[model samples]
Target: MKKFGIGQSAARFEDRRFLTGAGSYLDDENLPGQAVGVFLRSPYAHARLGGIDVSAALAGDGVFGVFTGPDLRAAGVGDLPCMADAPNADGSPCYKPPRPALAIGRVRHVGEPVALIVAETRARALDAAEAIFVEYDELPSVVETGAAMNGDAPRLWDEAPGNRCFDWYAGDAEAAAAALDGAAHRVELELVNNRLAPNSMEPRGAIASFEDGRLVLRVSCQGVHYIKRILLSGIFDCAEEDIRVICKDVGGGFGAKIFCYPEYVAALHAARTLGRPVKWVAERGESFLSDSHGRDHVTRLEAGFDNEFRFTGLRVSTIANLGSSLSPFSPFVATSAGVPMLSGCYRVPAAHVRVQGVFTNTAPVDAYRGAGRPEAIYAIERLMDFAGRRLGVSPGEFRRRNLIGAAEMPFRTVLGSTYDSGEFQQILDLALERSDRDGFESRRIAALQRGKLRGYGFASYIERCSGGAPEQARLIVGADGHIDLHIGTMSNGQGHETAFRQILCEYLEVDPERITVVQGDTDIIPRGGGTAGSRSVPVGGAAIAACARKLIRVAAGKAAELLEAAVEDIRFEAGRYHIAGTDRGLSFAEVAFRAAPQGGPAFDEIDEFAPGQATYPNGVHVVEVEIDRGTGVLDLVRYTVVDDFGQVINPDLLLGQVHGGIAQGLGQALLEDCHYDPQSGQLLTASFMDYAMPRADDCPDTDFSLRLAPCKTNPLGIKGAGEAGAIGAPPAIMNAVADALDADHIDMPATPRSIWKHLRKLAP
Candidate 1:
C-alpha cells in the first residue's frame, strides 16, 4: 500500500484491457436486433429544404425508417438544447436560436443533419441516405467571423440579426479608456486564434434503445449521467429517472464529446419507433464536418504602460465564432470563461473586455482541451511580448516584472476571478533555469553561424479547474474481501482509475490492488456533473476521500465492539484497527465481514453537492526555436515547462497528461488548422490528408517540473493538470517563431509557407 500510495507513481490499472484490445468502446457494442443510423447532410451551407422524394429509400430492403425533420417533429421529439440565456448589462436576454435535431425549413451549415436513414446494416443506411435527395435553393453564406458580423451580413437566425448572439462586456470600460488616454506608452495588436478540430482518436458514436418507457444511451463521451439528463429532460421531455446512460472506455473527448448531438436524440426516437436498438457512428470525414470546433476568434487588444514601465490598463474586443448553432456550453466558453483569462498570471488592475459571439457557416464551436483559457492566454501573452518589443525589453524580463507575486495570494482581477494561489515568479525562475536562458545569446550567435535564425519565447498561463456542479461517490467494503468505488466523473483517457485509487489508498489506508474504481454509468451513481474542465481529480477524488473517511469511522466503531474496547480507545493503522494500549487489533476486512451479517453492509457515501469556486492551476513555459531562413522551416530545439498543480496525486499520470496537452498545443501552433472555403462555405480541411496533425517526429522531448502551491479551497490540496500544457504552449511557440523572424507578429501554425512569406518580406 505504501509503494502504491498518493505520492507514488503507480501505473494505471486500466491499461491492461486497453493494451490487449479488450476495451469496450461504443462501436464495439452489438446489441440485440440493432440497426445502424446515418444522416443525410446538406450540401450547401445555407439552403431551403424542399424535399418530397423518400419513397425510393422507403421501398428499399431492410430500411426501418427514413425520418426527416418534419417526421421527427411530428413524433413529438424536442429541439436540441442551448445554454440558459443570461441578461446583459442593459438587462436584455441573450439571443438564443432553436437548435432542432434535424433540418426543417432551412439548413444553416453544410453538415447540418437533414434526414435520418436507419437500416439493418450501416452500408444499407449509407446507400439509402444517398438515394433520398432533397432539393435545395442555395442562399448566400456567411463564412468568416468578420463577414458574419458585417452590417449587411446574411442572417443565420432570425432572432439573432447580423449573426450576433450576445454583445457581452466585463470589467470597467471607462477606467481602461481613461488610463489609456494618459498612458506613457501604448500598443495595439490584432490577432486570430485559429479554429481547430478536436480529432479524438475514435470518431464519436452512440447506441440508444427504448424499452418499457425507459431510454438507455451508450456513448463514447466524457460523461454518462449528463447524456441521460439531456435525453430525458431536454430532448424527449421525459422524467429524468427513466433514462440510463453508459460510457465504457471512451477513446478521447477533449471537450468535443461533452454535448448531446442530433444523431443521439434521433437514435433514441428510432429505437422507440422500431422497438429495437439503434446505433450511429461518425466516419472520420463526418467527424471533421460535424464535431464541435475550438478557438475561432478575431481579437483586438490595447495595452497601456506607465512611465515607470508598469502595466496600467488593458482593453480587449473579441469576435468569437460560434459557428452555425450554439452547443450546450458554447456561450460560456466564448464569453463567460474566456473574458476572465485576459490578464492571465499577470496583475492587470484596470482592464475592460467585450466579446461578440458571432455565427458562421461551420460546425458549432465549444470547449476543446483548455477551452476558453487558451484563447485568453494566447491574447494576453502575445500582447505582453508585443509591448516588450516596442519598449526594447526582453519578453521574459517584461513578464517577470508584471507577474502576480506570491504575496498576492487570493488576488482578484478586474474581470472578477480570484486566483486562489500561485508561485508565478517561482515557476518562471524554474523554467528559465531549466531552459538555460542565460546562454541563449551564445546559441543565437551559434545559430547565425549555421545560417539559421534562433529565438526564445516565454508564456505564463493560469486556468480555472475542478469545480463542477456536484459529484457523488459510494464506497462499499463488501463481505468477501474486495472493495468497490463508484464515482461520478467519467474518464476521457486521463487515468482516473490509477489516480483515484491513489487518493483512496492515502485516505483509507487500504491496499490499492484490492480497491476497484467504477465510473461512467448513470444507474450506479444517482447524479453527477460529468467530467470536463479538469474536475476529475480535485473535485471527484476529494469526494472519494470523504467517503473513505466516513467508512473508516464506521469501521472503527465496529472494530471497537469486536475487540471489547471503547470506540475512543481504538486506533486504525494500515487497514488494521488496534487497541490503543496493546498490540491486539482486527483487520478491516474481518471487521467488514462480521459487521455485514450482523446489521447491514459496511459502506459510506459522500456528495460534492455544495457551491464552490474553481481552483486555479498555473504554469510557465519556455520554448527555443531555430528557423531555416531559406526554407522557412522551424526546429524546436528545446522545450521546458514548470507548473504549480498543487500537490501531485500520481506523478507519472500527471506527467503523461502534461505531455499530451503540450503536443496538442504545439499542433495548433505549428501544424493543425481547420479551413473553410470563404466563398463556397465548404470545409477544405475535412480529413487528415488535408488537415495537419502533429506526429511523433514533430515533437521534442518535454522537460517538466513542479513548484508545489496547494489549493486553499479543496480539502485534498490538489489542483488540476489536465489543461495546463495546452494553455501555455501556443503562445510560447508562436512568440519564439516571431522572435526568430525579428517581426512584431505572425499567425499560428507557422508552417513553412507562412514562414517563407514572412522571411521574403524581410528581404531587401
Candidate 2:
C-alpha cells in the first residue's frame, strides 16, 4: 500500500488539535452573557405530581428563571417525538404515550426532569434547583424486563395493557413452528442481555441561544441536522429556518447523543425567555441517570436440529425493555434492527422472532455501539453452544456443518436478510488457524498444572450494515491546488478526517495534504444522514467517490477547452489533462487557474449516493480463556478474529475501531452492568465506583486478520466495520467461560460472584 493513500495507515489529521487541547467540544464553546441551567430531577421512580413551587428559586440571587412542564405547555411546546413505527403483531398501532420536556402529571422514572433553573453560574443554578419543592405520591415501579408483564406489575401507561408497548412478529412464524415440531432434537435456553450505559468520554451537553426570534443550538451530537429537525418539528413547533444547529467536535457518541433530549429543549426555552445563552452539561452522575441506555432484553431461544445434527429451525421470543418511555429509535432497535439477524451465519430453513417492547421504571433504552445486532448474535451464538453440548458434538464442527458456503453468493436468510457476499466457513477456518486451535490441548494442560481450567470457543456472526440512508458529499477544487470536501456524516472519534481524505486521494490522485474534510455543521453541509449504523465509510465514502467522478467529468470539459481539443479526444491522468496521442497538456492547477481568474474553485459539485441494498459484514471470533477454579477468576488468554469487511480504507483506524469495540464488549461480558434497585428503581451503578468499565488488562492482545470479499451491492465494494467487534466478542467469551466450567448455560456480566456461585453448584 502506498503512503497517504487508500489502504495505508495514515495518521489522523484531527488528533494534533485534540492532543494539544485545542478541540472545541460542546462544553468548551461559550457565548457572551451566557447563563447556566440545571434540571431538577424527580427522586421517586414512579410518582404523581400534585404541585411544583418554583417561586423561591426564581427569587434567589442571579436566578433568571425557573420553568416547569406547565410553563412549556403553555408556550406551545409540543411533546418529544418518538421516530420509530412498529405495529403490533395483530396489526394495531403501537401504544405510544406522550413525553413532555418536563414531568407533567406523573413522573415514571427517577431522574425525570421536573423543572429547569437558569442562573448566572452553574453553582447558582444548582442552588436554585435545590430550593424548588415538589409534591409527589409515589407508586409501585417495575424495574426488570421479564417482570414488566406480570399480572400484578405496576402500570406505567394506562393505554398499554400489561405494560406492553408493542408485540412485533418477524419472519415465517408458521414455517418455523412446523419445522421445529418435525425436528428430531430440540434445545432451549433463557438468556438475558444486560443493560449498559453508553459512558461516552464526554458526557452529554448542549448550549442553546435564542436571538432575533431564531433558535441556535450547539450540542455534542452525532448530527446537527437531526437535532434541528427534532427540535423544530418535534418539540418547538417552529419553522425549519427558525433553528440553526452547530456541532464542531464531539468527544464520543456511541448512539446515545443521536437523539434530542429534554435538556436541549429546556435550555432553548430558557435562553428565549432570559435573552441569554443557556448551557446545560450533565455531571457524571446525571449521565448515569439521564442518558439513554442499551440492550435490556430477556429472551427465550429454542433451536431445532435434525437427526444429522443440522440446524432445522430457530424460534426467539424476547421481552425488550423500553425504559420509562420511548426514545427515538427504541422500537426499531427492538424489532426490525435485530430480528433479521437471528439466523446468524447458518442456513436455518425456518426462523421466527417475536420481540415485545415493554415499559419499566428506568432510563430509556435505544441504540448503543452494535445496537440490536450484538444482542441478536449473543443469543444465537449462546444457543449454538447449548445445542452442541446437548448433542455431544463439538461446537466448532456443528457450526461448520450448518455454515453458509461461498457458493451461495447472494444467500437470503429465512428471516429475510440477504448476505451480499461472504465466506463464512473460510473465515471460521482462518480464525481457528490463527488462534492455534490444534495446540489448545497443550495450553489447557499447562493451565491445569497451575490449578486452572482452560477452554476454547467460537462465534460466527453476520451483520446487516444499516447503510440504507442516502449521504451527500460536496467537493470544491480550489484554484490554489487544494480541495475542500464537506460531508454529512459526523465523526465521534472514528477518524472520518483521515479516511475520507484517503478516498479523495484515490480518486483525484492528489496529495492527502491538499484535501480538507468538513462535517457536522448543518448550515455548511446542507443535508446529511449523520453518522450511525457504520455507514460513514461505506455510504459516505461512496458519495465522495461519486462527487469526485462528477468533479473530474466537469473539470475534463474545461480541460478540453484549455487544451483546444475535442472533448472526446481529451484524456485525464494523474491530475493532468492532455490531447490523445500528444504530450501537450495542462496541469490541474493550470486549468483551475485558467477557469477562475479570481482564484476560486474551478469545479464545485455535490453528489448523493444510496446503495441498492445494505451490505453484510460477516466474521468469526475465537476466544480462549483460563479460569482459576478456586476463585472463579477468568482471564482471556488469546483472542482471534477473521472478518470480511469488503474494502479497507485505513488499516490502522480499522484496528482501533475493532480494539475499542472489543473492550466495550468485554466489559459487557465480564464487568459492566447497569443495575437498579428492584424495590426503589434507584440506579445502583450511578458512578464509576459502582460501574465496572473494562480496564486495559481485561482485553487480551487480539490476533486479527481480514478475508477480503468485496461487497457486491455497494458502489464502492465496501462493507461496514464499525460495530463488528462488539457484535462478536461477548458470545465468544461467554462460550469459552461455559466450556471451562463444564456448564450448559450462563447469563451475561458473568461477574466473579456469579461464576463462583455456578461453580459451587457443580462441586457437589
Candidate 3:
C-alpha cells in the first residue's frame, strides 16, 4: 500500500493542533461587542405557567435584554419543528404538540427554558436569570415509560391521550404469530433499556450575530446547513439565504447536537434585535438537565425456534419514552431507524414489532452513539443467548444454525431491510477463536476453585447504515498550490480530517499536508448532509472520492496540453503527469499552478454521492467474564470482536472509532443509567457524582480485528463503522453476566449492587 493512501494507518495530522490547545470550539469563540446569555429554567417537572416577573432582571446592571416565550411568539417566531413523525396504526399522523423555542403556557419538564437573560458577562447573565421569578402550580408527573403509557398517568398533552405519541407497528403480525405458535420451543424476556445522557467533552453552545441583514450562527453542532434550514423553515420564518450557520471543531455530538435547540433560535433573535452578538453555552449541570438524552425503552421480546434450533420467528413490543417533548428525528429513532434490524444477523422468516412512543416528564430521548440500532441489537442478542440456554445448546452453535450465510446475499428480512452482504457466521467463528472459546471450560473450572464463576457470551449484530441524504464535495486546486476539499459532513471529533485527507491522497497522489478539508460552513459549501447515522465515510467520503476522480480527469487533460502530448497518451502516476514513452511531464502542483495561471481558467470539480441503498455492517462480539461470588463483582477478563465494515479508509482511525464506541457501550452495559425520581419526576443522576461514566479501567483491552466483506451499495464499497462497537458490546457483556449468574434474564446496567442483590436472593 502507498504511504498515506486509502488503507495505510496514517497518523492523525489534526491531533498535534488538538493536543497543543489550538483547536477552535464554540466556547472558544468570542466576537466583538458580544453579550453573554443564560437560560432561566423551570424548577418543577410539570406545572402551569402563571406570571413571569422579569422586571428586576431587565433592570440589572449591564444587562442587555431579557426575552420570554410570549415575547418570541409576539414577534411571529415559529415553534421548533419535529422533523420526523410516525403514523398511527390507523394511518393518522402522530400527535405532535407544538414545541416553541421557549416555554409557551406550561412547563412539562424541569429545566425547560422559561426566559433568556442577556448581560455583559456570563456571570451577570446568570445572576440576572436567578432574579427572574415565575409562579408555578405543580401538576402530577409521570417519569417511567410504562407509567406514562398507563391510562391513569398524567396527560402531558390533551391531544395525546394516555401520554402516547404514536401507536406504530411494522411487519405482518399474523405471520409472526403463526410462526411462533407452530415452533417447537419458545422464550420471552422483558427488560428496560435504560436512559442515558450524552455528556460530550464540550457542552452544547452557540454564538449568534446579525451581519448585513443575515443571521450568522456559530454553534457546536453536527451539521451547519441542516441547522440553517431548520432555523429558517422551522423557527424563524426567514428566507433560506437570510441565515448562515458555521460550526468549527466540536468536542463530541453522538447524535445529541444534530437538532435546532431553543438556545440557538433565542440567541439569533436576541442578536438581531440588539444589533450585537449573543452567545449561550450550557453549564455542566445545565447540559444534564436540558441536552437530548438516549435509549429509554421498555421492551418485551419473544422468539421461537424449530426442533433444529433454527430461528422461526421473532416478536417485539416496546414502549419508547419520548420524554417531555419530541426533538427533531426522535420519533423515527425508535421506529423505522431500529425496527428494520429486529432479527439482527439471524435469518428469521417472520418477525413483527410494535413501538408506542410515549411522553414522560424527563429530558427528551433522541439518538446517542448507536441510537436505536444498539437497543434493537441488544434485544435480539440477549434473547438468542437466553433461547440457547433454554434449548440445551451452546450459544455459538445456536447462532451458527440461524446465521445468515454469505451465500444468502441480498436477503430480504421480514422487517423490511434487505441486507446486501455479510459473512455473519465467519465473523462469529473468528471472534470465538480469538476469545479462546474451546478453552473456556478449563478457565471456568479453574475459576470455580477460586470461588469465582466464569462465563463466556456471544453477540452477532448488524445495522443498516449509510442510508440518508446525499453528500456533496467540491475540490478546488487553489492558486497557492493547496488543494481545498470541501464537504458538507461536519466532524465531531471522528478524525474526519485524517480519514478524508487519506481519500484525497489515494486519488491525487499528493502529500496529505497539501490538502485542506473545509466543512461545517454553509456559506463556503452550498450544501451538505452533515454527519449522522455513520454516513460520513460511506456517503460523504464517497463524494470526496468522486470529486477527486473528476479533478484527476480534468488535470490529465490540462497536463496533456502543458506537456504537448495527446490526452490519451498522458499517464498520471505518483502525482506526476507524463507522456507514455517520454520524460516530458509536470508535477501535479506545477500543472495545477499552470492550469490556473494568473489569468487562465481555474481548476475545480464538484461531485455528489447518493448511495442507492444502505449498507448493513455486521459483526460478532465474544466476551469472557469472571464474577466474584462473594461480592458479586464482575471483571471482563477478555473481549473479542470481528467486524465487516466493508472498505476501511484509515486502519488506525477505524480502531479509534471502535475503541471509543466500546467504552461507551461498556458504560451503558455496566455503569451508566439516567435515573429520574419516581415520585418527584426529578433527574436523580444529574451529575458525574450521581452518574457513573466508565473510566479507562472499566473498558477492557479489546481484541478487535476486521473481517472484510465489502459492501456493494456504495461506489467506495465502505460500510459505516462508527456505531458498530456500541451496538455489539451491550448484549455480549449482558449475556456474560447472565451466564455467570445462571439467571433467566436481566436488564442493562448490571451494576455491582444489582448483581449482589441477585446473588443474595439465590443464596441458600
User: Please, what is the whole-model Cα lDDT of each candidate in the order they appear?
Assistant: 0.87, 0.90, 0.90
Clashes of each: 0, 0, 0
Provide the lDDT at 318 for model 2: 96
Candidate 3 on 465-494: residue-level lDDT in tens? Answer: 888899999988876568888999999989
At residue 637, give the lDDT of candidate 2.
86
* Candidate 3: segments with Cα more than 4 A from true spot: 599-601
TM-score of each: 0.98, 0.99, 0.98
Q: lDDT, candidate 2, residue 593?
A: 77
Candidate 2 C-alpha error for residue 100, in Å: 0.6
Candidate 3 least-lDDT 10 residues: 595-604
Q: What is the lDDT of candidate 3?
A: 0.90
